[model samples]
Target: MTGDQGTGALAVLELLAQEAPAARIEALLHEARRAGAADAELAELARAVELARTVQASAYRGRDREAALAALVDTAHDLTSPYDLDSLLRVIARRARRLLTFDMAYVSLRRTDGTSYVRTSEGDTTALNAGRELGEGPSLGSLAEERRAPVWSADYLDDDSVPHRPGIDAVVRAEGLRAIIAVPLRSGDTTLGALYGADRKVRHFTPDEIGVLLSLADLAALAIQQAALLERTREEVTELERFGSVTNTTLTRVRHLWDCHTRLARMVLDGARLSTLARAAADALDGVLQVRDPGGRPLTAADELPDLDEEAVTRAALQAHTGRSPVPLPGDVWVAPVTAGAEDLGVLVLRASAALTDEDVRLLELAAQSVAALLLIQRGTAAAEGPVRDELLQDLLDRPHHADLHVRERTRRLGIDLDVPHVVVVARPEGGELGKAVAWSSSYAYRCGGLKAVRRGCIVLLLPGSDASAVARKVSAELSPLLGHPVSTGAAGPARGAAGVAGVYEEAGRCLDALTALDGAGGTASLRELGFLGLLLSTDHDVDAFIASTIGPVLEYDETRMTDLTRTLDAYYESGGSPTHAAEALHVHPNTVSRRLERIAELLGEAWQKPAQALEIQMALRLRKARAALRAHRTP
Candidate 1:
C-alpha cells in the first residue's frame, strides 16, 4: 500500500460521509477509481470506516449503561416507601413508562394457577390493558412467565410465534400496539407475574430496557408478599380481642354466682330458719321464694308469697325432683327440689317478676341446698321434743290425783292454765295412718298452744276453748287432711282443773264410741250436742236411777205381767188425770181405764196419784219414751 493510495482512500471515505447509502457508495467508488488507488488501498479505506463505526457503537453502549444504572437506583429507593400492593403496582407502572419511554406500561400478577391478571397501567393506551387477563398459552407476558425471562416483539400484530387471543388482539388493535417488552415478576425461583412496556409503532427493545423492568418486577413481588403478611397479622389480633371479651363476661357471671352462694351459706351457718333463708334467697334472686315441707305445707308464711297456684307448683316440683331439672311453671315461676344428699326435704318455688336466666337457676339451686339443711335441723329438733310432751299430757288426762301439782307446774311453765275453760278432744283416726296422725298432732301442738298425744289407738288434745263441740270440729277438720283420711273427734269440756279434764275425757271417749257405733265416720260430737243421747253416752248422768226410783212399780208391773199399767199411767198424766180421756187415749173403755188407775195406785203405796208423785211419774214416763226413741233411732 502506497501513501498516495491511502490518501485517495481517505478522500473516498470523506465523500462517503458527505453522501448517503447505495448511490453515495457508487460515487465513493468513482472517486476512488479517479484517485487511481490500488485494490489494497481500497481495503485499507474500508477497515478505517469499520473502526470508526465500532467507536460510535461503544459510546452508545456507555450512554445506555448510565440510564439503566439510574433507573435501577430510582427503583431501589422507591421500594423503601411504605406502599400497599395497589399503590406499589401503580408506581411501578408509571416509573416503567418514564424509564422505557413507551406508549404504555402496566403490571400484572400471576394467579395461583399461573394466569396473568393485569393490575395497574400507565399512559395513553393503559385503558386497553386495565383489568385484562393474559392467558398462559403464548402472549408475551405468558412467555415471560413460562420461560422465567424477558420476552419482546418488535411488531406484535405480525408476530405468529405467540398464540393469538381474540381479546388481546382486539385491545392491541384498539391501542395500535406494535411492539411490547415483558419481564416476569419473580421472588426466588417462582414467577409472580409480568411487567409490560409497549409501543404503538414498530420498535425493537434493548437488553437494558428488559433488565430495568425485571428490577421493578422484583420490587412489586416483595410489596405483594409484605401486604399479605400484614393482613394476616391484623386478622389474628381481631380474633384475640374477641376471645378476651368473651372470657371477661364469663368471669363476671361466675363472680356474681359465687357471691350469692356465700351469702346463702352464711345464713345456714348462723342458724337461720328455713323461712329466713328463703326470704334472703328471694332478695338475692329478685323473686318470690317458698320453702315447703315434703307434704307441700309452707314452712314460710304463705302470705309473704305471691298468689301462686299451689297445685301447679306441686306438679312442677314433682317433675323437677324426678327429672333433676328446673321445671317452668305458669307466670314465670320455677320449681326446684330442696334435697339433703338423697333425702328430699321439700321444694323451692321461685316466681320472678322478670325473665330468669340460666345463672339464676343455678343460684336458686344453691339456696335450695341451704334451705334443705335448715329443714333437716328443724325436724331433728321436733323429733327430740315430741316424746316428753306426750308423757306430760297422758299423766294430766289419766290420773289428776297423782299429776295435780306436776300438771299445774307444767302448765305454768308452758304458759297455759289448767284452771281455764278447756276442751278435751279425743280423736280416733279411722284412716289407720297412725304415724302421720302423730306427726300432725305433734306439729299442731307446737304451732298452737295445746297438748296433743296419740294414745290407746286415738289422738288426744287438750285445748283451751269456750265450746267443746266447736273445738272438736276444728281438730277434726285440721287433722283429717294431714292424716290423709277422716277423723272422728269427740269433745267434752269447758271443764276446769285436772279433775274436770279427767271427767270430760271419759265423756269424750264415750262420745267417740257412740259416733263409731252410729258409723258416723269423721263426725265431731260433744256432750252438749248429744241431746238426750248424752244421758246414755255419758257415765256421769243418772237417768236410769231416776227412772227406776220414780216409776219402779209401774216398770215392774209392765215388765212382769204383760200389762198396760205403765202405759195407762203415762196416758192419764198426759190427759190431766181424766179417766175417760185416759181411756180414750189408751184406746180402751173408761171403766177399764178406772180399774187400771186403781191397780197403779195400789202398786205405788197410795200417794202415786198426788201432784208431786204424779209429776215424778210423768217425768219418768217421758224419760222412758225418750230412751225408747233414741234406741230406735240408733238401731240402724
Candidate 2:
C-alpha cells in the first residue's frame, strides 16, 4: 500500500463507477483473462477482485450511482406526462428523495395572500404525518416571499435563525441530519412556493443537484396554473347552460300570455262587458300591477300584495317619467312608466324578491311594453268591429225572413264562442252624450273579445258565452266606470240564431226603456240589481203610476205658467248646476234661470239636487214622455 498505489487505485475506482455496472463487470473479467490464469483459477480470481479491491466502498459507490441515474430518468418521464397538480407534485417529492439521498422531501405552494403551504410530501411516518402545514419554516417561507433561488442549511437544528416545527428539531437531532436544500418553485418571474429536501448527515449539495430540483419545481408550478384555468373554464360553461334554460322557460310563459290576450280581444269585439276581461287581465298579470285611478288612488289589489300606498307609487312613477330612467325603491321595488308613443297610459310597479340585475330590468321593461301595445290594439279593434256587428244585427231585425245566411256564416267564421248562453246589453247614454263613451267602451270590449254596437245615442253589447245574470252584472260594472254616471244595463236572456238575436235585441230595448225610466226618476238601478222601480216601469200599469207620482207636479207647473219648466230643468241638469250655462241654454237671464232653478229645487226639496234625487227626476221625466206617447198612439 504505497501512497502512489493508493492514489492510482482510487482514480481507477472513480472511473469504473462512472461506467455502467455491467460494463465494469465485463472489464474485470477481461483483466482476469489477461492475467493468464487457468480456466478454474480465472473464475475464482474474477469472483474475488472488486474494481478497486475495496468491497464495501465499491459496492456503496456503485449502488448510489445507479440509483441517481434511475431517478433522473424517472423525473424526466414525470415532467413530460400530463398529470394534475397533486399527482405531479407527489412524483416530484418521491423522486427528489431518491436522487438527492435525502431522508424526506416536500413540495410547498404559495397561497394567493403570499403564505406558503406544504402541498405534497414523501418521508417516514413521523415527518409525513404532519400534513400539509408542516415544513413551512422561516427559511422556506422567506425563499417563497423573496423569490430566492435555493437555500442550504448545514446542521439545520443547530442554526437558531432557521425556522423549525415542533418535533422537527428533535427528529433532525436524533437522525444526525445536518443539511437542508430549499429551491423556489417558480414559473417565469412568478415564484409559487419552494421544494425542500433533507439529508440524515452533513453533505454539501452541489449546484447541479439544486438546478435539477429547480427545474422539476418549475414543472409542478405550471401544472398548478393549468388546473386553476381548467376549473374556471368549467364554471363559465355551466353558467351559460343555466342562462339558456331560463330564457326558454320565459318564452313559454310569454306564449301563454299571448293566447289569453287573443281570447279577451274576441270578447271585446263581440260587444261583451269588460268586467270579466278586467278580471282576466288581472289574473294574467298576477301581481304585476296594483290597479289604481288616475289620481293615484288605489282601486283594487291582488290578495298576495301588501296594502301599498298608491301615492308613493305615483310619486315614484312621476320621478321615473321625468328622469326617463328606472327608479329603484325599498324592498327591491321599481316603477316603470307604461306609455305608448306620447300617451301616458299609467305606471307599472314591480317588487322583485331578489336583487335585479341589468338583464332582469331589461326583460321586465320589454314585458311592460308588450302589455301597453296590446291595450292599444285591442281598443282600436273593438271600435272598428262594433259598428259592423251592429249593422248586421239591424239588417236582420228589418227583414226577419230575408236570406241573411251570409251574416250568420260571417259570425261563425269569426270564431265567436257562441255555445254558451248569452244576453244583449243595451245602454242608452244619459244626456245623449254616449257616442264618445260608447266608442271608447266598444274599443275596450273588442280588445276583450266582446261585441259592441252603437245606434243613435244607445250602445248595445252582445255578450256571447256568458249567462244572462253574469252579462248583466258585467255590463253594469264596466259602464259604471266609463260613464262617471250610473248606467242601467238590460239583459235579454239567452239567444242563439240571428232571428233569436234580433228578438233579444227588441226585448233589451224594452228593458232599457224601463230601466231608463227608473234612472230618470232618480232611482238606483241595474239590470241585475233592479229595485221596485224596475218592476214598476216594466209593466204598463206600474209605468203609468211612476209617471204620475214623479213628473205630475212639473207638468202641472209647466202647463199653468207656460214657462217651459221641463226645458229649464233640462238646462239646469245639462249645465251641471252652472247658472250661466243654464241661462244660456234656456235663452234667459242668468238671474232668472237661477231663480227658477232655486224654485224647482225648493219644490223638489233638498234631496232633489243629490245624485239620488237627480236620478229619480230624470227617470220620472222619461216615464212621463213614454206615457204621453202611449196614450197618443192608442187614440190614433
Candidate 3:
C-alpha cells in the first residue's frame, strides 16, 4: 500500500511541474497547440487550461481589455454625431471620466481678452463656478496659456505654487485622487480650449490616453466653427425678410393715396362741396401724416386723428421750392417736387420706418416724380378756369383757411393736396449750440411737407390722411434722443370744413403751450391724457411761485455748494427713479447713491414727495437751465 501511494504522489508532482507560469501562459498555449496531442479529450483540456491561464495573466496586469474596447466604441459614436459645440464638449467630459476612471472632468475656453472660462464639466458645474472669469488663479487655463500642451500632476498637494482652493483639495483627497491630466483643445494653429480629467487613484497616464483626448478636442473645435457660421447665416436671412415686409406695405399705401387724389380733384372742379374733397383727403391720410392748411391747421373737423408735428415737412417743402438738394427726414422722409414741367405745382413726400435702402429710395423717388407731374397739370388747369380747375384746388379748399392766405392760394393754384389734417411742431435747439439743431430740424422738416420753422425754432405739420397721434408720438420719440433732451409736441384734433381747421390749429397751439410748460418746469410729462388742472398747469402757471416755492431750495443748494444734490436729482430723473441704474450712470457705488437720494428727499421738503409735485419741480429746473443757456448765449 505504501509503494502504491508513493507512485501516485510522484505522478501528481510531475503534473505540477508541467503547469505553465503566469507570465509564459501565451507561449505555453502556443506550444500545446503545436504539439501532437492525439486524444481529443486531452487536447480540449489543454486548450481550456491555456485560455484560463491567459485571462489570469491579463487580470494580474490590471488591463480591462473589454472595458477599453467599449470605451473606444463610445468615442467613435460621439465623433460621428452632428452635435453642436457645447453638447459635444459635455459628451467629451463624461466620456473622459469613464475612460480614465476619473472622479471629475471638465473643459475650459480662453477668450481674446486674456481671460479663461470653464465651459463644461462632468460633475456639478456650480460647485466649480464653471464659465465664470478666472480672475486670479493658477489653473489648467494658466498651464494651457503658458505651454499650449498637455500637463499632468500626480502630487498636487505638494505643489504650493499652484492656486487651488482648499475645498477642492479636500474633495480630491476624499475621492482618493492622485493625479490630473489636461490636454489642450486645438485646431490647426488656433488653441480653442482645454480638456482635463482627474483620476481617483494614483496612476500614470500614457501618451496614448493624451492622444485620444486631443483627437476628441479637435472634433469639438470643428463643431464650434460650424455653429458660428450657421448663426450668422440665420441673421442675414432675417434682415432680408424684414426689409421686404416694409417695402410692400409702403407701396400699397402710395397707390391708395393716388386713387384718393383723383376723386378729390373731380369733386372740386365740378363745383362739388369743398368739405367733401377735404374729408376724402383726411380719410386717405388718416393714421399716416397729419394733413393741414398752409397756416398749419388740422383739416378734419370732428373726427381727429392723433396730433402730429409737421415742422420738418414744411421746411423740406420750402427747401424743395428754393431749388436745394432733397432733404432727408428722421424716418427716411423723401420729398419730390410735384410739377408737370417748369411750372412748380407742389411737393410729394414719402416716409419709411427704416433708413431707405438705395433700391427703396429709387423706387419712392420714381413714384413721387410721377405724382409731381400730375399736380402741375392739375394746377395749370385750375389757374386758367375759376373754380372747377383741378383736384389739388378742391382738396385744398376742403379744409380751413390758413392765416397765410397767399401761401394757401399759391398752394391751391399749384394743385397740391393742402387740405389734409396736419399739426405744426416747433423745435428750439438747446445746449447753447444752434447749428446742429438747425441742421437736424431743417433736414427733418424738408422730408415731410407739414414741417416748417418760425425764427430759430422748427414747426412740423402732420398730414391729413396720417394718424396724427401716432406720427406725433413717433416724431417725439425719435427727436428726443437726437436733441439729447426731451422735446415738446403739440397735437391737433381733426377738422373738416375750411373754417373748422382754424379750431384744430388753436388746439395744436394749446398742445405746444402744454409742452412748453412741462419743459420750463424741468419735468417729464406726456399729454396723452391730462386732467383740467394738469392742462392748465401745463399752459398757464404762476412762474414766480414755481421758481421761488417749488424749486427754490434745490437751486440754492446747487449755487452754494459743490454737493452732488443737483447731480443726484438729474440722475434720478434720467434713470426714471431706478437707484441701481442711477448709481451705474453716476459711476459711484450703489450705497453712495442711496445716501445721496436720502439727502435729496430731506432738502426738497414733503411737497416734493408727491409725483406731481416732483414733476413740477423737475420742469422748473429744466426751464431755468434752458433760459440760462439762452441768456448766456445772448450775452456774448
- TM per candidate comes to 0.39, 0.36, 0.29
Worst 10 residues of 3 by lDDT: 381-390
* Candidate 3, 1-636: lDDT as tens digits: 244334433433344456545444344435544664335534454555555656465443223433443454456445434456678778878887877677788887877776677787786424544564565456655676467577777666665655575555665666556677777765435676778787655667765466455545544454454344334544654676677754666555444443444454344334333344434433443313222322234322324333323677778767765663345666556554443223343454544445655434433333333333223222222222211222222333344454456446644533434567554333333344555454444334433433333333534343343444566665666556656765656655454434554454455556666756655422222233332333353333445545655667766786798677777777877888788988999999989988877877788775565877777767766766777788889955
Each prediction's number of clashing residue pairs: 0, 34, 76
What lDDT score belongs to each candidate, Candidate 1 first?
Answer: 0.73, 0.58, 0.52
Please identify model 3 stretches exceeding 4 Å from their true place.
Answer: 1-82, 159-178, 242-636
* Candidate that would win on TM-score: 1
lDDT of 2 by residue, 14-112 (tens): 655575455564565576577664676554544444534464454564354445434544554454443566777787788778777788887777776
Cα lDDT of model 1 by residue, 1-636, tens digit: 788667755665675556434455445556665888677876776665565456456546645655655565556456545467788788888888888788898888878876778888888544667888776577778888878778888998999886678888888898888998888776545777888889989997765566556655655565565455445544654676677753666556656876776676556545566567878889888888877766776667323665778889889878878886678877888888976434566788788878888778878777776675455433433333444456667777777676477667756755568788888899988866587688667756654567777778998988888788888887777677666788998888778877777787888998888888878878998765565466667766768756776778778988899898988888888888799999989899999999988898888879887766676677778988999999989956
Give candidate 2 misplaced runs (Cα > 4 Å). Answer: 1-330, 383-387, 396-405, 431-435, 465-488, 494-497, 519-528, 531-636
- Give candidate 3's TM-score: 0.29
Q: Which segments of model 1 are wrong by more than 4 Å?
A: 1-281, 291-307, 339-346, 401-405, 408-424, 431-436, 447-449, 463-485, 492-504, 526-636
Please identify which of the two predictions, 1 or 2, would achieve the higher TM-score against the true structure: 1
Of 1 and 3, which scores higher on lDDT?
1
Quote the positional error of residue 199 for candidate 3 in Å: 2.8
